[model samples]
Structure formats: structure tokens, C-alpha cells
Target chain A: MTTDTIVTAAMLAIGDELLSGRTKDKNIGHLADLLTISGIDLKEVRIVADDEEAIVAALNGLRGQYDYVFTSGGIGPTHDDITADAVSRAFGVECIHDPDAMTLLGDMYARRNMDFTEARRRMARMPNGSTHIPNAVSTAPGFVIGNVHVMAGVPQVFQAMLEAVLPTLKTGATVLSRSVQSPFGEGDIGGPLGDVQKAHPQTSIGSYPKFDGTSFSTELVIRARDETILAAAEADVRAMLEGIAASRRT
Target chain B: MTTDTIVTAAMLAIGDELLSGRTKDKNIGHLADLLTISGIDLKEVRIVADDEEAIVAALNGLRGQYDYVFTSGGIGPTHDDITADAVSRAFGVECIHDPDAMTLLGDMYARRNMDFTEARRRMARMPNGSTHIPNAVSTAPGFVIGNVHVMAGVPQVFQAMLEAVLPTLKTGATVLSRSVQSPFGEGDIGGPLGDVQKAHPQTSIGSYPKFDGTSFSTELVIRARDETILAAAEADVRAMLEGIAASRRT
Candidate 1:
């Protein structure tokens, strides 16, 4: 990929708990932040149930569209943890018990004096021809098949797996952003801000409205890959806010 | 919809800020919880950037697949706030400043001694034949056209809009759930849990692993619509855990 080539990614959070509201997702934001800083744009995110068909459909849809697809949840040893099988089906590959994963998990269980039960052995399963993503917190490793990086549903394990996988993927130019806080509300600055955004076509300008009980304020953010372009857009945004502030004085 | 019929829904979270990780989303979980209690199954969730084409595509896709579609964000006055237009395009309708919304916003602005400028007036833009979803926090109303309910991006306002719109929709049977904490880890219980799940095909059983820095434990949740069925499944799960504990003691 070229230097300016945007490395885009999508996230697939697979779990019935998420859709059922039993578990609030922390992975989406965490992954988005990590991917952004790594110079990979997180373009889309889908949260689906633990159903195999849903997981397969979402994985296929995302893996084809983005450079990388990171998935969390549905990788445990339980019956509902079917992400590995779903991913295998998505790629038309056989879901198998890999020897490396089996050995790693067996060793961990032995060290802890555990029985390495069939349920625990279930963690050794992965799609054929996939690489293991070592989990530092728990020894049951996640796997990488095609462009999809499957990780654990547990936050600690998911984060650790991401850390292990991130360094290996190709990245793009890190996007730089500048925030300009407007004392006035979004309604107050929307017109001029739109003009400023149009003037700076290369940059993406977003206007966020904030409510602090008593009144409303706006936070304007300008994002771009080029520092010079970001700075130029920042100046225009600052000037626009100043113009609004001056008019309010009159 | 019939009484026993399941009412399903999908959430579309729109904004560039969300995708950029500049804004961590709180709306998806909030909506999921609300929908769950209302007996509406939140089947899927998709978060996309503030692009018109992307917004239109997501809206159309979600609106077709689910009984109800809720969208939050990008209804502000700025240029990037293109959700209304996107919704209009999704429905193939004209996006216009509704007369009622214009008057409502105009009256509120006048009462607050603020000008209903062109920027603020942008809040009135919605699909031509849509009904307003009132915002108690901010006077700028969201709108509902066809099965799609579009709300503000700000958490406070989005919640307010959801409250207004939720009461007006049809709901299904409330799903009842029971949680049983296991003294053992997920690896210890995964096998028995799988057996329990197989025996009780009506109930959806989920095993969630929890790590508290020192050790891992599991929380097993059983969900179903019938109270008697739920209780039966709960009993089985409890018995399974007790059996595991007895075996460990021996």
C-alpha cells in the first residue's frame, strides 16, 4: 500500500449478551481508538448475537470490505462460543483443533494443576491454517484467519490479543485532529462552521453539541492526515468561533 | 403484530466522531436496555460515519430487516449533519422543513429570546411526511418516517427522544432472565453448561467469564419468555453447579 493509502478496518462484536443488554461493550471504543492511532481507520462496526449464521454473515460482509476485521466475543469454551466455527464457515475452511493451541492450553492447565477437561480443550479449536493470537491474561489463544482477527469476549483477553495482533498489520498515515471549543452552541456556529468545512475540503469537520444542565456548548473537531492542512483548518475554525463571539458582544 | 409475536429492532448510530473514537458511544447500550425491557428484541446494531451514502445505505438495510429501526446522531445544523437527508433518500422522499417543526422550533427560540437562524432552522428538516419525536431536553425535535426513528446524537437529547418514541411502538413478550454465579471458572462449567443448554432448548443460556485480578469466575444467565420454563432451566443450572462443587470437594 502507498503512504497515503488509508488502511480501513471494521469491528464485529459477536455475543447475545451485547444485544440482550446484559453486557455493555467496551471493545468497540477501545478498538476504534487503537486502530485510529495505528493509522488504520475504523470505518464500521456491527454487533450481532452469538448465532453462527449472524456471525458468519457479518464476518463475510466486513472482511471483504475493510483491510482488517477485528472481532470480539463468542470465543469462549461454552457452546455459545461459536465464532471460530462461524469464521471457518465464512472462509469455507475446516474448523479444527490446532496442535499449537492444544499444546499451549494443555501446558497452562497442567501448570495450574487443572484437569484440562473437554470444555477447556474446546479452546484449542480454530480454523485450519490460522495463526494463534497469544492471550497473556488467559492461555486460551484467539486466532487469525484471512483478514479477520478473532479475540476473546472478556475485556482483558480481548485487549491483550489486540496488542499481540496490531503490530503485525500494515498501517497508514496517522490522522491528526484539532478541537476548538465554542462557548456558543452548535446552533450558533453551524452556518459559519459549514462554510469553514467547505473551505477546507481535505479536512473532516465535526460539530458536537454538549449539554451541561444549564446550557449548551459546541466542540468542533477538524481531522486530516496532513499537519499543515489540519493547522490551516484549525485556524479557520478558531476565526469562525471568534466572529460568533464578537457578534454576541454587540 | 400478535401478542406472542417477537418485535425485533436494529440501531443505527451515525457520526464521524463515533468512528474516529473521538466519541465513545453510550447510546447503543442505552437503547438496547430500553428495547429489551420494552419487550422489543434489539437484534443488531451498526455504527457508521457521517457520510450521506453510508447513512442512506445503513438506514435502508436496517429498516428492511427489522420491525423498527432507531438512529441516533447527525441531526444538527452543521453541514455534516446529513442524517435527515439520508433518511429521506432511504425512503425516496423529499427532505423539507416541516411546518409544524418550524413553528415548534420558532416558538421555543422566541421564548428563549434567541434567533431561529438558518442554522437553527436546519433542525426542522425531516422527511416530508414524518411525525415529530419531541425532545424534552432540547426543543429541536427528532422525526419518525415509516419504521425509522431518527434522533439526536447527544446522549441527553437522544435519550429524551427515545423516551418519546418508545411509548408509541408495539412491544412483544418481555423476556425473563435468571443469573446463577458459579464458584468455578468458565472452563470448569462449560461442559455441564453445554449439556444443560442442550436439555433446555427453549432457554438461551450464556456463560460469561469474569476476572477480578486474582482469579476467574463465571456468571451463567438463562433467558426465556415463559416464567415456568425459565424457573425450570434455572433449577437445572443450579443443580449442575452444585454437582460440580461436590465433585471438586471429593
Candidate 2:
């Protein structure tokens, strides 16, 4: 894709553990940051349980809306690992044991002198007409069907799979951002920051309040795809903070 | 709700920073764990941007499906902070400055000797017919309208608001969980775990793979509302692990 093209993406994190709060998700933020730097706009994220219907529905919902969909979790050998089947259902394709995946897994298990049991063999299954995403951390590869990239739930495997998948996707304009830390709280600069944001329509400005044990402060962030526009917005935000500081001093 | 009744909930996290990867979300997992213990099933979580249309659409989509909906972020004083307006639009109600919230904020600013500007006043606005969810950490109150509870983005404030809202919620049967640590990897236990899951249909058994730097292990979790079912499932899982260990030793 051209640099100016706007590529969008959504993440679907599938696991009953995530929904049950047994596991706090680390993949969503990791994927979001990677997509942002790769110049893809991450528009939305959904975390659903391992139930096949829920996974299928969420996959269909996100796959249609964004340019790319990345899913983590539910690709293991366990019964609850149903993401591949759900993705196949979403795409109206057959879930099958891919020969390439089977061979890779078989070789790895043979080298380790471990029996490739039926449960371990389950990892070779993927949606038909899908290509495997090689995992450096694990032998069982993730698969990509249509625009959905399915990866493992383990953080290391997920990150390794992403490394393999990211290079293949099309990218858009890289967003640039500038942050201004203000000793003043949001209450002090919110009005002026709002005005600055309106004036610099090219920039998306955000005000985040931070509370230390004793007091509060604000961090103003200005983001844009264009460096010139981003710099302009940053200047305005800094001026706004200075104005507040000066008034307080006087 | 009665003890046996299944009370489900969904969380909507509204912010641009979350999607941009500028900020990692802590509230989703926090809320998920809290709800799980309080007997509320957290079925789904969606993270959307700061845009008004996106917020309203997501809010509407979730509020009808779940018994309770919790939203964090986008209620700050900046221009991009538009969750309050979006929630009002979702409910087709006018967002007005609640007198109680206004007085509360006004008194807070007065006590701190800070100017109560229009931006600070914006925090007092909520949908009509909404009751405030008090924030002990900060004076700006969160609010509850219909089944939706909107709270702050800051972890401290969000937690304080949750403390105030949790007691008012209707709860279901407290789900009890048992986790068995397996020395073997998921590959070894998946088949037997699936069997245990099928036999003990009353419990939901999940296999999660854990990787240290060198090797992989597994954690099997069994959850059920009934203690007897949970115990039975745990026993089966332990037996399965023991069988694997015995076979390997021989």
C-alpha cells in the first residue's frame, strides 16, 4: 500500500481465562503498539470467551469492518482452543489438518523424542486455504485465512508470530506524536487545551491526568500523520501550558 | 437477581490512547476480576476510540445484551473526552449538568482554591435521570444511567468509583474455581483434560500453557458455581495428571 493509504485493523482476543479474569491479557496492548508503528490504524478490540459461537461472531464482526484482523489465544491443543474452528466457520471453510503444519510439528516432536499424540496433533489443524505463520518460540504455527491472523495465547509465541506476520501486511502513513508534561492539572489547562485542539484540527490532542500520592498533573499529547501539523499542535499546547503557569505566578 | 440466576455484564473502554497504544488498559482486567468474585459473569469487553459515534454505537450494542455495563475513560475535561455525551445520545437523553455533581465539583474547587472553569464544569454533566457514582479520590463523579455505569479512566479514580457502584449491583451465584499445576506441558494432558471436561460437564475446565525461559508447563483451571462439581472436576484433573506421570515414569 502507498504511504498515504489508511489501513485499519481490529484485534480479537479469544479465551475463557481472559473473560474469567484468570489471565490478564498482554497481547492486546502489544499488538496495538506494533500495528500503530507499522502504520496501521487499530480501530477496535474485542475480548471474547473460547465458546465457538462467540469467537465466530466476533471474528465475522471485526474481519468485515477492518482491513486486517489479528486474533490471539485458542489455538492450543486443548478442547477450549477453538479459534481455528470458529474462524473456519466465519469464513465458511473447512477446518483441516494442514500437511505443512503437521510435518513441522511432527519433525519437532520427533527431534525432542516426544510422542506426537492426538492432542498434540490437533495443533496442525487450521482453516482450509490458509497459510501458516511460523512461530520461532513454538513448533505449532499460527494460520492466516482471508484477513484474520490467528496466533497462540502465550506471550512469547504471540510476539514471535506477530514478527512473522507484520512484514507481510500492507502499511499506511506512520502517525507521529508529541507529549508535553505539565505541572498543572487537567483542571487548570482543560479549557485552553480544548481551544488549541479545535484550532489545530489536523492534530488529535488528548489530555491525561496523572495523580501522584499527593497531587495531580496533566500530560498533553498531540498526534498527527503529518510532522508539520504535529509540531504546530505541540507548540500550541506548550504555549497553553505556559499561559497557565504564568497566570499562576502572577 | 437470585443466587442461581446468571448475571452477565460487558465492559466498554472508550479512549483513543488505548487504541493508539499510547496507554495500556488496566481497568478491563481489574473489572473482570472484581465481577468474577462478585458473581457477575463478564462475557465481553470492547475497546473503542474517543469518537462520539463509535462510543454511542458500542454503548448501545452492549447495554441491551448484559445485565450491567461498565465504561471507563473519555469523561475528562478535554475536547476529545466525549463519553458522557455519547452515553446520553445512546440513551436518547439530554446530557445536563447535574446539580449535585455541580455542587460537589464546585465545593471541591473552592476547597482547593482553584478556578472552576468551564472545562472543569464539563465533568459535572451527565445524562438526565442518572445517579452519581461517587469518586472518593477525585470530586468529579461518575454516573449510572439505565444499566450503564460510566467511570473515570485514571486507575485510582476508576477503582474508587467501582467501590461505590459494586454494592448496588445485583449478584448471582459466586463461581468457585480450582487450579491444578501440571509439571507436564499442555501437549501431554490435552486429550485427558478434554475427557475430564466432557465427563464433568458441570465444570468448565481450561488448559493454559506457561513457558519459562527453558520449557513449558500447564495450569488447568476448573470453575463452577457448585462446589461439589468443582471438587469433582479437580479430582478428575489430578487423576489425569497422575496417570501421565505414572506412564512417563514406567
Candidate 3:
């Protein structure tokens, strides 16, 4: 892995269930953490419905902009599962039944005495010239076409697929962060925080406020690819918080 | 409210915390449900970092494609909270401190014997020609410019702002859905499911699979604006599930 390479990734979460508010998404955060630790920056995320045009457009929009594009959901053996076809359309490639995928799924179903119907056979199809992404939880495999990786939407299956794919890619410098909180409200700390941000332009500072019905508080987090810069920003934030506290006391 | 009108919306979730995986968003689901009930369709959702260019690009991309664009996060009294400025840039407008927002926040702080510091005054800023979306939980108000609505990132404050804004907007016919689950896997029901989908092109049919380590199952959901079409598609799905179950029993 090149140390200078700033690897970036985007996620396409495909499902109507997500848009309908029936299922809360758990994959975005999981994949975000995975990518962050692997030294790949998660740049953007788009959640689209299971529709073909929506999937194709989002796939096309993201795949070219980022180094890697990971998609979760819509690979199941159902009519609504149009991810594979949409991916094929996005890349202008033909989707075919890969022999390896067929063998893995066919044999597994045979062992279970389950009929591998035509709908089940859809699992074996992938964009032409793509490789299979193994699924340990279930025998059905995900596939990678170009830089876009298609994976399951199920939380457990998505995690397993991410693990399977992570090691194969080259990683860069890991982004690190430090968090600090104060009873001081965001308004109380905003001015000094801006000064802190200007002093450390390399680090990104975020202030999140929390209200417990009676009082407001803020948690400030500083992040950077360099540990030294991250630490320096953290120190400045701490000093600012202390200054705010002192003013409140006096 | 027009029954035939198709109301569409896009969401821009602006925060480094979201892209960094430090925060699990709870506002998307809440807004999705709110939009569904209000007869507006949430067509797309984008989670972007706190960076100015990224937010501006996403804001422009989504705001044009959908009828309404709702933004969450970054509207706070903090240095990293750049959402108001970003929105102003997206709309080619000036961001200035609004007297209405200042009065509300100023009085609230005065009641608590807290000084309305410069940092706190930042919360009163909004894009020019915008209207305020009152926040009941916190004194800081969200604002709307053009078709774009900017709200807080905190769950409580975001929800309160949404409630205040929703009632003022025009709504369309509600998109309704019905769901059913079966122990039969998706592959077991896929063929007939396709036929069902073909029979009801106006309604969207989705098939979601579940695995419990021992067996596979599927949940099917059908949705449409017209209740009659939605009900008819649901019947087709239920019959398909029953046929698969009967075959399994025999």
C-alpha cells in the first residue's frame, strides 16, 4: 500500500424497505468503520430504492468519482433484487452465470435437499468478467464488477462480505480521531472552536450538541490522517473547553 | 393537497461524523416516515461530509432533481457547523443573521441568565430570503431557502424542526403499502413473484430474505398510491406465498 495514496470509497444502499422506513439501515455505519480502519476514506453514501433506473444512475454516478464503490442490498433471490442487473447496465457489461458461483450454490442446495430453482439460479449470475465475493454465512456469493462491489443487505451477511473483500485491497494511512466533551454548550465554545480550526487546517473538527431537556452540552471530535496533527488539534480543543469552563466559573 | 400530484423529496445528511461512522443517524428513518405520511415520496438520500465543496455539490445535485430537498445536520452553534453557509452557496444567496431567529434565541438565553455570546449568535444565521423552522427542543431555529429546508443534526432538534415545517407544506396522495412474511425462502417464491410483479406494474413489489442459521424466509411488501392497486398486488403476493407453502407440505 502506498502511504501517499488517499484511498476513498462510496456506498450505494439499495432497497425500497429503507426508503419506506420499514427497516433501519445498519450497513452504512458498519462499512464506514471498516473502510476507516482499512485506511480508505468513506466519502459519500447514497440510499436509493430497489428500482432499476435509480440503481443504475447511482452506480454510474459513484463508481467513477471514488476509488472504490461498495453497494449493500438487492442481491437476494427475489424479483425486487435488481442490483446485479443494474450493475451490469451501469458498466455496460453482459451478466452471465459464473461457473464457480453456480458450483458453490448448486452443491450447497443439493446437500440440503433443496431445489435450486431458476430464481435461485439468479444468485450465480454476475457481470461478465467479474469475480465472486464469497459469503460465509450463506453459500450464495456476492460479485465484484470493475471497482463496484455488490454485497448483501442483511447486516450479518454484509459484514461477512466486507471482511472477505477488505484484505484483497490496498490500504493507505489510517485516519485517526480524538473526542472531548464539555458541559459547555456549543454556542459557548463556537468562537474559540473556529479559531482552533483555523490554526489546524489539516484536522477536521466537528461539534455535536446534546440536550437533556434541561441543559445543552457539546462533544467535539478532531480527526486527521497524521497522528501528530490530530493530537495538536485535540490539545487546542481541550484548552478552549477549559477556557470556557473558567469563564463560566468567574 | 392534490390527489394526483406526485410529491418527491431528496435528503442531504451533512456531517463528518456521519461519513466517519462516529454517529448512527436516527433522523433519516424519522423523516422517511414523516414524508410517507405527508404524501411525499423520499426518492433519494445522500450523506455527505462537513466539507464545503462536498455539501455544495450534493445540495445542487439533489435540489434540482427533486421537488423538495431536506438537509439534516450542521445547523448548530459550532465552528464545524457550516450547513447554513453551504446552503447559501448552493442557492447563490447571502447568509446573514436573521432578526427573528436572534430574538427567539436571545430571549431564551436571557430567561436562563445566559449571555447570547458570539458563538450562540451564530445559530441565528440563515440564508437570505429564508423562513425559520422553529425548534421546540432547542432555541436554535432551522431555516428554509428556496425549496431547500435546513435542519439540525441532533435527533431531538431535527425532529422538532421537521414537525414545525411539515404542516406548512402541500402534500399529495399518500403512498400506502402492505407486507407479509413467510417461512418459504425467496427462491421458493421467485418465479410466481415475477408474474405477480408483472401483473401489477403500477405497484412496486419487494422481496426481502431472512436467514435464521437453520432456515430461510422472506418478507414481501407491495406499495402504490392507489389503495385499490396496492390491495390487489398484495393479494397476488399472499396467494403466491400460500402456493409455495402448500407445495412444501405435500
Candidate 4:
């Protein structure tokens, strides 16, 4: 298998508040950034609810398709937190409080002489035969069962934990990116952009035309591994957009 | 069922750039806002890549579990723009360019004298037997195959499309929301919050602690349908938060 072929990952962002507009789920973006730097292809990203069936289905689908699966949220202290149970159900593994997770959590609270109640200790539960992904920022540790890495929903904590675990992951080829932005709609750029793409079949050029109330702007993106090819592709995109912009001006 | 029975919905955010952190998706928040007003419980939100398999799997998972599904992204002129096709595949329909969609689309371009190329024409190709979701901002449209509503990934366009279509949606009794922010970490509020939650079993309270650089604050949200019960829960949350904030002052 080639570097491009080896590793592909999926993100599962799980939360109810995220869907309610109460909170923006930032964990997926963070994981995406971290995973990409480590050369893991973030092939899929999913934001699912706290529901058992939905989470189970997503976990199964992603695990079956990709090399690694990273799930964030529904692993908190609330009643809505159901990731552990659902993951256990998905893998058919026993969902029990792992000793290592409990010890870490206990030490965290014991250092301050705080009560680690049943609810707080709920964070210690892990799918059987899985390793705990340490929580550096918080005591609640995420765990790995099969290919799925269960993580925190909180942004800072999620990033820190992912950084810790990413080093151990098998990586794919690092995806390279370059872009060109212009004050025009995508339609104006499509025809020429398509021609450029037809030439550089290896590179993926994306035209993102944004329309605000005032005016429209198009951000053309060229993504690939080869620097020379990416640069060549980007030059063509710039030329196409410039030609369109020049024509529109006239 | 009862007004107490929850009405659930899922958000499907489809984009590869979002997974790269190259773009932070804001449509989930917009969808959440719109769904909240309609008494539709935004149960889950998912972000997928530009790949067709990812989109199709997400659609199946969300559509199977939730009462309704709203998908955003992959509905543009680019080659990776495949949300409509994936939805078609998910519903097992022949992904065809419908005649009605073509008529509306033709009329849209006829007014402007713009040549509708294959890429532009692709926008009009929705699932067979799907309903057209009119785009107020752009002539390029979204469609509804079953209960799932396909919308644009752009925030403004997504919100506009949702507003246009939501009125016709089958919504339930309005969900009431009340929140109180405390200058404390979630851990600090966890104990008392647990007690309050136990006492008010009818209401579901969500705690989100935000760290703004130097200090931390938690927003405690209480949501339910019954007006009197919602008010009572709000008062309790306010009292608890005020107690914490007042104690901090001393």
C-alpha cells in the first residue's frame, strides 16, 4: 500500500447541545487539524446525537470503513453521556470501570481531598480490553476499543488528549493544500477551473464561492501532496479567476 | 404521543474542508436556532467529508434514528458537490435531473441569460420523487427526499432555506429554554447541579463551562415544554448560580 493508501480516519462528534445551537462543536475541527498534521486521512467526520442507536450505527459504519475512528462527547458526567455504553454495545465489549482510569481519576481528586462520587467516577468506565487515552487537562479519561478512540468534547481537553494519542497512530501521506480567493461567484470560475482540473487530474481543485449581502467572493482551493503539481495547479486557478474578474470588470 | 415526548432532528454538515479545519462550519448553529423555534429537537449534528460513501452513511444513520434530518453542504457546482446524489442513493431512488427542478432552474437562468452548463445543471438533478426546496438567495436548489431536507452548506443560504421550509414542517409543542451563567468551572457546579437535576426530573439541564482566557464561566441551561415547570426550573437555576457568584464575591 502507498502512503496515501495506509491510514484513513473518521471523526464522530456526539452531543445534543451541538444540534440545539447551544454550543458549537469545535472538537471535530481540532481533531481534523491534529490528525492531518500526523498524516492521518480524516476521510469522514460525523456529528451524532447522544442517542444510543445513532451513536452505535455511526461507530459501526466508520469503524468498518476507516483505519481509525475518533469519537468526541457523550462521555461526560451527565445522564445524556452515553458514548461508553454505546461503544461497548457497538464492539460487543463489556463496559466496566477500568482500574487504570479509576486510579488516575482517584489520584486526581485525592490530591485535592475531594469526593470522587459515583457520578464523577462514572468517567472511569471503559470498554473491556481497551487502553485509556489519558486526559491531561481533566481527570475523565477517554479510552480505545477496537479502532474507535473515545475522546472528550471540551475543545482544550480534546486537543491535548488527541496530541498525546496521535504519536502512537499509523499515519497516511500528509495532505498538502493551497488556495486562491476572488470577488466573484463559483459559476464564473467553474468552466476554466474544470479545464485546469482536467489537466491536473491528480490534484483536487475546489471552488468555494461565497455570497454575503454586499457582494460575492470565490475561494478556489487546490489540495494534493506534490508541491510542484500543487503550485502549477494553483497558478492555473489564479489565472482563470483573474481572467474572469478582468472580464467581469469590463 | 404527549407534549412531554421529545421531538428530535439531526443536522448533517457535509464538507471535507470542515474536517481539515480549513473552514469552521457555522450551519449547525443556524440549524439549531431554526429547529429550536419549531419545537423540533435538534438531537444530533454530524459533519462528513466530500466523499459520497461518508455522506450516504450519515444520511442513513441520521434518517433512520431521528424524526427528521437536515443536510447541508456538497450541493454546489464543484465535482465534490454530491449531497443531492448521496441523498438519492440513501433513499434508493434513481438520482435523476427532475423536470420540475429543471423548469425552475431553467427559469432562474433564463431571467439572467446565463448559460447553464453541466455543472450548473447538476444542481437541478435531485432524487426521483423528491420535493424541491426553493433557494431564495440562489436559483440552485435543495430537495426533500422523505423527511430529510437537503440544504446549502453556506450559513446564510442554509438559514434562509430552513426558514422557508420549516413553516411546512411538522413541529411539536414549543420547547422553552432558560439559562444562567456562573463564574465557576463545571466541576465546581457539578455537585449542586446534580442535586437540582435530581429534584427536577421533568426538566433536562445542560451545563457548558467556557474558559475565556484567564477565567472560567459555566452556562447552565434548563429546557422543557411546560411553561410553569420551565419557569420553576429557571428560578432554581438562577438561584443556584446567584449563590455561587455571590459566594465568589465574598
How would you encode candidate 3's per-residue C-alpha lDDT over B1-250 as one tens digit per residue? 2445888999999988888889999999999989998988899999999889999999999998988999999888778888889898988989999989989989998998988999889899999889989888887889988889999998988998999999988788888888888778888888889999999989888888887876778888788988888898898888888887787789
Could you tell me which 10 consecutive residues in candidate 1 chain B have the lowest summed lDDT?
B1-10
Model 2's TM-score against the true structure: 0.98
Stretches > 4 Å off in candidate 1: A1-4, B1-4
Q: What does candidate 1's lDDT look like per residue over A87-201, in tens digits? A: 9999999999999999998998899899999899889999999999989998889999888899998898899999999999999999899888889998888888889989998
Please, what is the TM-score per model? 0.98, 0.98, 0.97, 0.86
Cα lDDT, model 1, residue A52: 90
List the lowest-lDDT window of 10 residues for candidate 2 chain A: A1-10
Considering only N, C-alpha and C atoms within 3 Å, which residue pairs clash in candidate 1? none
Clashing pairs in 2: none
lDDT of 2: 0.91
The alpha-carbon lDDT assigned to residue A169 of candidate 4 equals 88
In model 4, the runs with Cα more than 4 Å from the true position are A1-5, A239-250, B1-6, B92-113, B116-118, B181-199, B212-217, B231-250
lDDT of 2 at B187: 88
**Candidate order by decreasing DockQ:** 1, 2, 3, 4
Residue B33 lDDT (model 3): 89
lDDT of 2 by residue, A1-250 (tens): 2445889999999998998889999999999899999999999999999889889888888898999999999999989899889999999999999999999999999999999999999999999999999989977999999999999999999999999999999999988888899998777788888889889987888888899967889888888998988988898888887887788789
* Candidate 3 pairs with clashing backbones: none
lDDT of 2 by residue, B55-143 (tens): 99888889999999999998888788899899999999999999999999999999988899998999999999999999899879999
Better of 1 and 3 by lDDT: 1
